[model samples]
Target: LRATHPPPRPSFCWAIHRDLFHYCALNLAYMAPSAREVDMALRLGFGWSLGPFEQWQLSGWSEVAAWIEEDRRAGKTLVDLPLPDWAMDPQRQVVHTPQGSWSAARATLSPRLSPPWLKRQHFPLRLLGEGGSTAASAGRTVAESEAARLWTLDEDILILTLRTKMNILGEVALEALDQALTETEGHYRALVLWSPDPHFSAGGDLKGFIETYTRHGLTGLALAQERFQRVVQRLRCSAVPTVAALQGYALGGGCEVSLHCTRRVAYTETNLGMVEVNVGIFPGAGGLTEVARRAGLRALAAQSPLQVADYLQEDLTRILRCTVSQSAQEARSWGWLESGDVLVPHREELLHVALTQALALAESGYAPALPRLFPVGGVEGRAQMLAGLVNALQGGQISAHDFEIGRILATVACGGELPAGTLVNVDYLLGLERTHFGPLLATQKSRERIQSFLETGKAVRN
Candidate 1:
């Protein structure tokens, strides 16, 4: 490969397993700059790494340090691909963020995304573009952000932390999701997607949203919504059976993101809700569509500020719809957690669990998916209840889901074949919210208060 830019560092060579090149040739997720973000459902919900590398090239090839010495002696182009594509970033920290594909399917349905229907692909792809030691993660977070790495789960059990302190995975998170899936090949036993920190995810960067809004108005908001919708859809469609581990709070886009996971295992005290409604805007990403299709169990119960009490009292498991654990350490012992699932309280065991599970799942059998539906995505009673969200979104209306509705919608969204290495981006269907609901969110009561607190760190209301 020739350099249009300066030669990178030799240290990056280790990061670029020669095996990746051979693997990238066959791995579709590595095919293009955009493919950095493939699908994210069960297959690669967490992240992707070295999924398609040729093991042999990487075997017995310990270079970097030696390579740097060699470059000093031979004057050859040292290092590897340039990471920071200033064309897409502001900080321009020379770093490469790799990726993998994401997808899933339920029983009887094939989960592996069928290889690219290239004829339908809008952009032409080159295999060389797929695998390279050099890759870029458009902004998202700082270059050294360790929390943002893509991961795979093939073992019957693994632990994750969506409630991350690092607030990992922004635009880069999506790419990581794809990359993780490409390497893992949508095969695993059980994946417990939990966060080590108490916060699931704060959601997309408001500054990023503001930039988009400043530039495109409603169009910008719609664009962001489209991107997130693609992400949630991909996560929802992951193939390996998965579960989301919740301990504290999974708010805003984070909450919406969690809705995309197959199962949400939470502590009774964990607070979950779509506070977006409080803010004047509806769920911008896929929240509106997702919420309107459900029975409103999580939304209704989470907003109460009484879920923990209820779970502790043992009055709401069926009603609240949560896997309330008495303590974080009890996540697995109590059955609310996967065998290897972990909470910060169990960090030591959790780390071991994470590694062990990652390796185990690296070679599990994968099936297609069957997305759930509701008033959320499981839209069921529409036959008798009302036209429903699918009906509304498919048309141009606003619809919300209670638990019953969410169940129905979840059902409908399920039951389809997932395109391997690619998540379905439903940006086309999300433009409506920008014009009708975006304005309200901008000026809404609850959202305004929350934004004010989030921005200035003060709470006016009691």
Candidate 2:
């Protein structure tokens, strides 16, 4: 029978999807205990970003309901379950304004409630009610660009959200960040660098880098790097307290941005790293500098020079290898997360925790970290670090390009050719990042690596 009368071309597929969606809606109306529960269960159990109903809401509740109704009328539904009146109603939505989430079993909208165990979790923007639909919404947004927006959160705290693809740091994002900082100075008590997306940020926009290099060559790339470094520097030196509410992938520039914050509140699953070496560039946006600074602090705490050397060796290896933290705990152990930083077990609690930390800092008389000099191994340290890289290069461990990147990273980490045990300020280390970054961006092999990563979304050994 099926072979004799085949289903129409695209309609067959459409019918299958329509029936599946209707079945889900029926489950919501009849079998599911609560809409939010089903949503949360699917999200937590399957790693879905949105629950079935939530996704349907985003796809257009009325439109999808209309499609299902048409299917039911045509007797095309696989289960033949009668469409619920609430599901068919054009005026009703799964997530309605003011009244909150719809209760299919109760046939009414009610304020959404989380379970006791999950009470701390929340959607940051949704606190603004209907106006919190998108970053472009006018109610909470203080500053916005195509790439990012600064929105007011609870307790006069501002959240700078990146809206770019994968939340990559680019020209527009940098501009929005600068604007956010300017607005946050005297008005807002604290600022949180965050995003609602699953990944915090992938890194610098490699596509943008390739485009810039293609059109204006290395000089354009240099200018872009300078802008990024300067913006991140401003975040480091901002007048008000800053918190980085991090989750998912916070790689390269994203990691650098979090590193500069006054405090970080990271989710348990957060993957943090300075992974610019994968694309053939070291962390030019002050990532390596921050690592070096942390290493220096650790060395300073050591009782003897031998211990200092050991500490420096362990930390410097992180830089050369472009180590990425697999979890919040690893991030802390790797020093990407500081002692005072927080780790949240739940993803939804990230922003809340960060905001709480920011508020605490503001209440306690938060001050930007004062610039200070830290000891670097300088020329001697650079040579000491390079010795291992040289051996790796001599063996089959790393490519020539990897060795070059490692050499530059070591030089910057050691504060250039200055003598051992020399104390240098943050600005000096930052300058080294900017200076060395250009030479690397100018290299053909580096460009190839960047292009490869941009095209394939994966790093090349070359």
**Candidate 2 clashing pairs?**
none
Candidate 2 TM-score over all chains jointly:
0.80
Q: How many backbone overlaps does candidate 2 show?
A: 0
What is candidate 1's lDDT per residue for 376-452, written digit by digit as tens? 21112222223333454456433232232222222222212222111222332244434444454344343444567
Q: Among these predicted structures, which one has the highest lDDT?
A: 2
Backbone N/Cα/C clashes per model: 114, 0
| lDDT (tens digit, per residue) of candidate 2 on 1-462 | 224555685577666667767887787767665566666677788877777777677767888788778778788788767777777787765554455656788876656654775555555324212333443453376767778888885639988888899899888888888888888897889988878888999888877777887888768877888888888988888889889989999988888898988899999999988788888888888887877777777777773322333556766676568788889999898777889999998777787788889999999998888887778778888888788998999997999999988888888888898887777888898888878887787788988888777778877788
Q: What TM-score quantifies how close candidate 1 is to the native fold? A: 0.41
Native-to-model Cα distance after best TM-score fit, residue 243 in candidate 1, in Å: 3.4
Candidates in order have lDDT scores of: 0.39, 0.78
Candidate 1 error regions (>4 Å): 1-147, 151-169, 181-183, 186-192, 265-269, 296-368, 371-437, 444-451, 459-462
Query: After best superposition, candidate 1 residue 130: deviation in angstroms?
Result: 44
What is candidate 1's CA lDDT for residue 153? 32
